[model samples]
Target: MNELRSWPGLEGDAIELRLDNIELFGSMMEIYFRHAARLVYNSDEGVLTLERKSFVNGLTEKRQCRLPRLRSLHVFLDTSSIELFVNDGEETFTARFFPHLDDRTILFGTHGHLHMDIEKWEL
Candidate 1:
């Protein structure tokens, strides 16, 4: 069995994580944005989504899943692609997108508090 390793983070804190193999466990709400493309994953409703809000052609992608209370997720972002993994690779979402170079923002919000361990990295 794989041991669950976690780093400490408080609720409503935008913590910086420095690993290609990033881990997110516990109940969470993540809004990850790679430039123009944004990915939103919510555990309460069991949904993962991606959308582009820019001058380029508008597009959206979504994957629905009923995962565990303490779920695992991995995300990869490149110049033209974004990959998302959920629940120890049980569910995955991947797409190619043109990113807006000027702004890249990621937001995380929970039902009441951010009851999850998350670390962000600049890739």
Candidate 2:
């Protein structure tokens, strides 16, 4: 059962989620996306970024997601887009970009010491 309620994630150090059953989403049939994501924290700038991999016309998305709540960052990645949600959807960012087939990895980058637990999921 690949139900969302049954989706698996982490609670410490880091968090990861992969939507293996995209088929459940009726409108996601033609969508080319993934579930796993990267989590990066820049304590210096108080930003949380969803890193993009090397690909054609690639782009990365960042938000002024402050600290204290920095430890709970969530990033959802698809082959061509990214979605960010934090504090249970309090702060959200919807990012779209172009990606190549080889662009399958998400980068977790930061400038200062900050702990993050990012959950990755795709629809």
Candidate 3:
């Protein structure tokens, strides 16, 4: 079980994280983004969770989910929807309602410490 480390913060067109030479676990990666960012996981079987607090109505939304072997992923906020994609264009996970307070940050890690080379890109 290796210790988890966080990458630097990015703000621009888009930020991408790439991990190579590492094994992936179901739920072993966390990402924090500043100013609402998207997350994409390309691995065998993985899990994702979102944590945020509301200010307008004092509401809180936290979600955790599992994904099958995927080829790609995308997330973004328009007006009132969170969109997700998987398998290079096979499946997608979309949800309604906004639950992001501020552009805090993004973190990535694994529950069992999967080895990987991660890269964050601004797109």
Cα-based TM-score, every candidate: 0.57, 0.44, 0.47
lDDT comparing candidate 2 with the true structure: 0.39
Models ranked on lDDT:
1, 3, 2
How many residue pairs clash in each candidate at the backbone level? Answer: 2, 0, 23
Best by lDDT: 1
* Candidate 3 structure, TM-score to reference: 0.47
Off by over 4 Å in 2: 1-40, 49-68, 111-123
Colliding residue pairs in candidate 2: none
Name the best candidate (by TM-score): 1
Q: lDDT of each model, Cα atoms only? A: 0.51, 0.39, 0.47
Candidate 1, 1-123: lDDT as tens digits: 123222333112222332233234434444545445655555556566666653455545444555544355566766566676766677776767665554344544444344445556554
lDDT of 2 by residue, 10-123 (tens): 221222443221111121111123333344444445554554344544444334455433423344555555665555566776665554555454332222222323345334
lDDT of 3 by residue, 1-123 (tens): 235355555323334444344456654455444423334343445555555445456455556556655334455434344555444445555655443454435445455545555455654
